[model samples]
Target: MKVGVLVLAFILAFFAESLPLGPLYAQLHPDFVALLILYWALSSSQVLSYFGIWLIGLVQDLVLGDLPGSQAISLVLMLALLYGWISRVRHLPSWEQLFFVFFLLLAQCLSAWLWHAWVGPIRWHSSLLLGPALGAALWPLLTYLLDQLQKHWPRRKTP
Candidate 1:
């Protein structure tokens, strides 16, 4: 059931991100997939393997028509960073947590940018910062909603 909800959320996020919001809106649009990946990495790390993270990135790449494997690599890089500090970070207050998430999102953006620059010329965009900033701003709300959803789920009894 947890897995189902997670998958559904990712699918919805992917669609939400792909919506045709025009040039300006699209530029400001947050990377929902990256947001979810960070959320789950902190909230339910056991549910997602490294390979699964990589696969999600690939799916994102395909959906967004980005260079193949670029998103996968970026996501994997974000996941690596998250794993090291998730224990301490998750215990922080929401405001502090926001900074950590923002850093992770920024790192993901930089990784993707560097990857693109490595492959070809890079056209730096304001959206690179805007998207992650928006995503970090949305983190508290997303955490609240997802926490409520998790609270509503039925728990299995331990023997």
Candidate 2:
């Protein structure tokens, strides 16, 4: 049931991201999938491993029609970073956690930009910063909602 909810949330976020919201809005739109992946990595790393993140990235790449492994690689890197620091982060206050999440989002955005620059045109824009900023802004609301959903999830029986 937890897995189902996570997958459903990811799919919804993917579609929400793909919505047409004019040129500027689209450019400034946050990477909801990436943010959710980070949240899961922090909140439920045991359940959502690097392999799951890679698969999510691949799905995202397919949906966005990008280079095959681009998002997969980026997400894997994000997962790796989260895995290394998750223990320390778990004990932080909400404000500190938000600060850390912002950096994570920044790193993900930077990696995606670098990957795109390597494979395509050398375009640089302020919108890259906007993505992470928006992601951090939304983190608190997302965390609360997901926490509520998790709390209400049916528990598994012990054998």
TM-score attained by model 2: 0.89
Tell how far residue 57 is off in model 2, in angstroms.
0.5
Give the winner by TM-score: 1
> What local lDDT does model 2 show for residue 54?
87
Model 1: C-alpha RMSD to truth?
A: 2.4
Task: Report the poorest 10 consecutive residues by lDDT, candidate 1.
Answer: 39-48
Model 2 global lDDT (CA atoms, 0 to 1): 0.81
Backbone clash count, each prediction separately: 0, 0
Note the Cα lDDT for every prediction shown: 0.85, 0.81
Query: Compared with the true structure, what per-residue lDDT tens digits does model 2 show for residues 20-107?
Result: 7788877788889988887777776475667878888899888878778878888888777877888898777655788778888888
lDDT of 1 by residue, 66-112 (tens): 89888899999998998888889978876679898999998998898
Q: Which stretches of candidate 1 lie over 4 Å from their true place?
A: 45-47, 154-159
As a TM-score, model 1 comes out at 0.90
Off by over 4 Å in 2: 45-47, 154-159
Model 2 clashing-pair count: 0
TM-score each candidate. 0.90, 0.89
